[model samples]
Target: MDASVIVAGAGPAGLMLAAELRIAGADVIVVERLPERTGESRGLGFTARTMEVFDQRGLLPRFGEVETSNVGHFGGLPVDFGVLEGAHQAAKTIPQSVTETILEQWAAELGADIRREHELLSLREDGEGVEIEVSTPEGRRTLRASYLVGCDGGRSTVRKAAGFDFPGTAATMEMYLADLRGVELEPRMIGETVPGGMVMVGPLPGGITRIIVCERGNPPQRRTEPPAFQEVADAWKRLTGIDISHAEPVWVSAFGDATRQVTEYRRGRVLLAGDAAHIHLPAGGQGMNTSIQDSVNLGWKLGAVVRGTAPETLLDTYHGERHPVGRRLLMNTRAQGLLFLSGEEMQPLREVFSELIRYEEVSRHLAAMVSGLEIHYDVGSGTHPLLGLRMPRLELSADGRRTSSTELLHRGRGVLLDLEDNAVLRRRAAGWTDRIEVVTAAPAGAAPGGPLEGTAAVLVRPDGHVAWAAPGSHHDLPTALERWFGPAR
Candidate 1:
């Protein structure tokens, strides 16, 4: 394919999308501004939802080695995401560097030209594609791509050059952070008493502890702004009752919880994603997780458009589906701040949750919110069972071997399960051998290992969402195929 996608940031979102596009047979180029990996790692963990997306592509084991989990909650309260109503059951704590490294490696394997120390200086969209101006070590050069994506953090030069408006409020409250050594703090345990203001200390995999100090009236500071290490250390001791007076500092920075989202995530042929698209408080470890998922959600649609198999409207769905998710992300993070900031005066609210914890539903919902597994869309397909729902990662049986639904998608193709091998079902996938892979799932209840009930012959999209499915149907198959696979064979 002569057409190429120029991705402006090498962060998780950009890298993930680049990998997806390359895997789908597109020429992809990823650009990063940093000359080298920053020893200072931010976005220290990913929710189970993010891990599930990776696991589907056989990318989990690559990242899981450096990851730690069994982490229970935020602030001082306990979290139980395993009870959330979905396939993703656990959260994994991994450094942003490791996450970026895994994605970079994956993209490289797919033959994406990932260039570092090359910053996006300017860009213009024409009828043919987008022409991006870059400033590299070799001086400046212009590159053309059929599409351009800005994953270049909150301050994206691509978005700015394209004249997109990022509308949102700046932070009013500020928090300081310090990654220190010689500090002894349990990774999972955080104080439940951090009302109005709170401090949290958690273990990052490398024996390094992360300390976050937030206060109600503290002045907001840019992330680049440095805070006094001793002051943060003293405050940590006061809040957690742990003295880390002699801990050697690794990295210290301050930031605000102020949140803002772009009014529109896309501007013409160039799109904004990840931190480049939306940023909010660091609450709930969502900052990075949401961005990675955004590209996953859009990657396939972009690929299909480039491949000439999907309508132009498909690309628009990236903004349609993702913008609302971004809105929810902003709101969810704000609510998390309240929980972390609740003081003695807010004791009643805690008492309510503590009391409500007995009811499994409330805890399950909150857990779902944090994990981001609870997201569902408006099903624009004129009403279908699986239209707006995520596919349940289930184990299925084939000619003899046991396999997970994710296994089939590792090669990045759509799957059509034929439950009974019904003649009509067999004929439904007659054409498009190049686009869809057909597989016959075992008879109804006989599927293997953790199969969700009421699923028979599922149609999995390239991005892993369930495009069309049937609980029990021999005749409804054709209609499902048309809407999802774009007027099937």
Candidate 2:
């Protein structure tokens, strides 16, 4: 095979998956249709869960210092994100273009072969592997790999070529997004519902102001190119009675509230991630963040299977875990669209939601949902509170040195954190040492009374979710080990 994996598209999901596959010691080749990066920043910043994912991978410092905020929104209502403990706040202003550049650089440094302007023409998956035909500058070329993953945005060619079943709602109305120069507008960070529809204004890094306008009764349009800046300005004027036609246009685009998800995330040797698997309204900037995470969840499992360390059934868990997340994504974004983009008919429901959000529990739930802090996988029936949840960051002291649970995961391998230095536990996991890291450490600082308080030991998956915890798990150490890391040697 030319490579173990072939990832289509160089967006956040593709780049991240390539990096992760390389980390798992699998050869990867990434193909992108664009010869160079488009400097367009469709997604701005990431959620708290994405921040933790990047931190655990040791990629946060590469982004320099990010601007984060505890303030967040659901639909158009406000929610305080501070209630979620032991995670970084959501980043607010880093552009998607910047994120792509960083991820591409990291993936390349990890030895991923990224070929630009090599558009995938077709694909065929045999029983053993997958073959893809591509159009490159030199000539048409065919590459074979053990697996192929599609991260090629909403209208994915691979999804079509593989015949995956995608069923959901279609675009009903259109909204405009524009970045402008030489314009000063009051910041409506969340959004404001006007007589016609909703309008939002926020400041960007380089003296640029970003505005979103969703005028009621605006029908969705079919277009191959971006809408004119005047169109956005006209909608803004109609919604807010403000004319900003004199402002210099940086870039303008249009989007819709079309929601969709594939019935399955995998089809034989071909699998899907990012927008290829799901699509939703760009509410609360969840699209790009969720896409990045989809790659994270799929990367290591596919790598392990390709490397012969794990059974192919491990791939089934990818669909089982992320498909539900995608379903909830579509549901929440569709609900947000109704709340934010609808006419006056939605005001009563909006008012009711506003009142509900006033309660701390309601706000916390909404905040966690939107920030991705509330996701919990079904690892098994375990009494531990954090059994299926993402492992909280815990400061640790091992071998007279300070380390962390987050630091141990930089290698993209499973971690068996032995909090009490259990020699028997280490012996039980000895056979899987090649596939996981066993660290014996004691809690430091405020970690004692927190989430890890009663846990004697914890088993964390490569994607940072807890697979098992001692003093509560129903399964023994080796059972959880074989379940996630394959049978021991």
Candidate 3:
């Protein structure tokens, strides 16, 4: 095989998956159609869950000082992200282009072979492996890998080539997004519903202002290229009665509220991630953030399977876990589109939603949903509150030094955290030491009534989700171990 994995598209998902596969000691090759980075900032920043994912991987410092905010939105309504408890706030201004550059560099440093201007032409999967034909700058070549993952945006060629069943609503209306210079506008950070439709203006770095205009009654158009800046300006004028035609246009694009999700995330040896698996309205900037999280969820499992550390059934959990998340994403984005993009007919429901959001519980629920803090996987039959949830950042004292649960995950391996230093627990997990790290540590000032209050030991998956917890889990240590890490040696 040329590589263990071949990832299509060098966007956030593909780069991140490549990096993760390399971390797990699997060979990876990433093919991107673009010759160079576009520098287009379609996605501004990542959600809080993505922030934690990056932090656990020790990739945050590479981004330099990131700007974070507790202020966010649900549809067009305001919500305080501070309502959710997390170690990091949602990063607000790091452009998607910057994110891609950082991830591409990191993946390359990890020895992932990234080929630019190489477009995938076709793919075939059989009992042995997957073979992909691609058009490269040199010539057409065929590459074979144990698995292939598609991260190639909404209109994914791999999705179609593999014949994955994608069924959902089609586009009904169009919206414009433009980045402009030589223009000053009040920051409508969330958005404002005008007489015609909704319009949003926010400041970007480098003296650029970003605007989104969704004019009611504008039909969705099929186009090969980006829309003109004048088209966006005209929509803005129609919505807000403002004429910014004189402003210098940086870039302009059009999008729609078409929602979709594949019936399954995996098809034999060909799996899907990011926009290839799902698509939704770009509400609350969830598109790119969710795509990144999808890669994080799939990366380690696929890597483990390819490396023979785990059975191939482990890959099935990827679809089982992320497909639900994608379904919910489509649901929420479509709901948001109805709330924010509809005509006056939606005002009553919007008013009702506004009133409902006044309650802290409602706001918290919406905030958690939008920020991706609400995700929890079904690890097993466990009563622990954090059993299926993400393992919260916990301070630890191991070998007379300060470390953290987050720090232990930097190696991209499963963690058997022995909080009470139980020798028997370590012995029980001994067989899987090669596949997981067993750390005996004492909690440093753990809160009395916190999520870890009664937990003696916890098993954390490589993706940061808690697979098992002591004092609550029904299954024994080795049972849970074999379930996630394959049969012990």
Give the count of colliding residue pairs in each prediction. Answer: 11, 0, 0
Give lDDT tens digits, candidate 1, residues 248-360.
88988778877888888877688888888888988778888899999988787788777767665777778988999999889877766766675676667766766776566
For model 3, how does the per-residue alpha-carbon lDDT over 164-247 read when each residue is reduced to its tens digit? 999998999989888899999988855488898888899988999999988888999998999988888888888788899999
Q: Write the per-residue lDDT of candidate 2 for residues 288-319, one digit (tens) a residue.
A: 99999999999999999999999999999999
| Most accurate candidate by lDDT | 2
TM-score of each: 0.90, 0.98, 0.99
Order the numbered candidates by TM-score, best leading: 3, 2, 1
> What ranking of all candidate models by lDDT puts the best one first?
2, 3, 1
Query: Which parts of model 1 are misplaced by more than 4 Å?
Result: 1-3, 64-71, 74-76, 185-188, 191-196, 222-231, 234-245, 380-387, 443-456, 471-484, 487-489
| Of candidates 2 and 1, the better by TM-score | 2
Q: Give all candidates' CA lDDT scores.
A: 0.74, 0.92, 0.91
For candidate 3, report its TM-score.
0.99
Better of 1 and 3 by TM-score: 3
Model 1's TM-score against the true structure: 0.90
